[model samples]
Target: MTHTYKINGMTCDGCRTKVENALNTIEGVQATVTLNPMEATITMEKHVPTEELQDALSAAGNYTIQMTLPPSHDGHHHQPH
Candidate 1:
């Protein structure tokens, strides 16, 4: 499953890299952190608790992560070409 989280305390590209690297360490987790939105989208092979993600970030730096609603697909849909 894929999870999106809102992250705080990231101030620059370096911060973003740190967050991403930290999250990626978790088993079965692939994370992408973006600076502008200050959020991380993690793709997991299995369900990983939110707390686990939080702990990883906390250990990495002065960062925090909270589970957030995934982006809506209200109107956008893909049509096979």
Candidate 2:
């Protein structure tokens, strides 16, 4: 599954890398972090709790992450009703 989240406390490209590296450390999770939008698009093998993500972020730095609306980049396309 794929999920995007709003990431806070990033100030530069290094911060961006830190956040990305931190998130990617998780098992079966791949995250792409952007500084402009300050968000992380995470692809996971299973549904991982937000708390687990938070834990990893905390270890990397004083960063916080939360769901971005919900499945904004979950690789799903829907036809117009």
Candidates in order: C-alpha RMSD to true structure: 7.3, 6.0
lDDT of each: 0.92, 0.93
Local accuracy of candidate 1 as per-residue lDDT tens digits, 1-81: 888899999999999999999999999999999998999989999999989998999999999999886566886666899
lDDT by residue for model 2 (1-81), tens: 889899999999999999999999999999999998999999999999999999999999999999876444767877799
TM-score of 1: 0.83
Per-candidate TM vs. native?
A: 0.83, 0.84
Q: Could you tally the backbone clashes for each prediction?
A: 0, 0
Top TM-score model:
2
- Cand. 2 TM to true fold: 0.84
Q: Which ranges in model 2 have alpha carbons more than 4 Å from their true place?
A: 70-81
- RMSD of model 1 against the true structure: 7.3
Kindly report which residue stretches of model 1 are placed more than 4 angstroms away from their true locations once superposed.
70-81
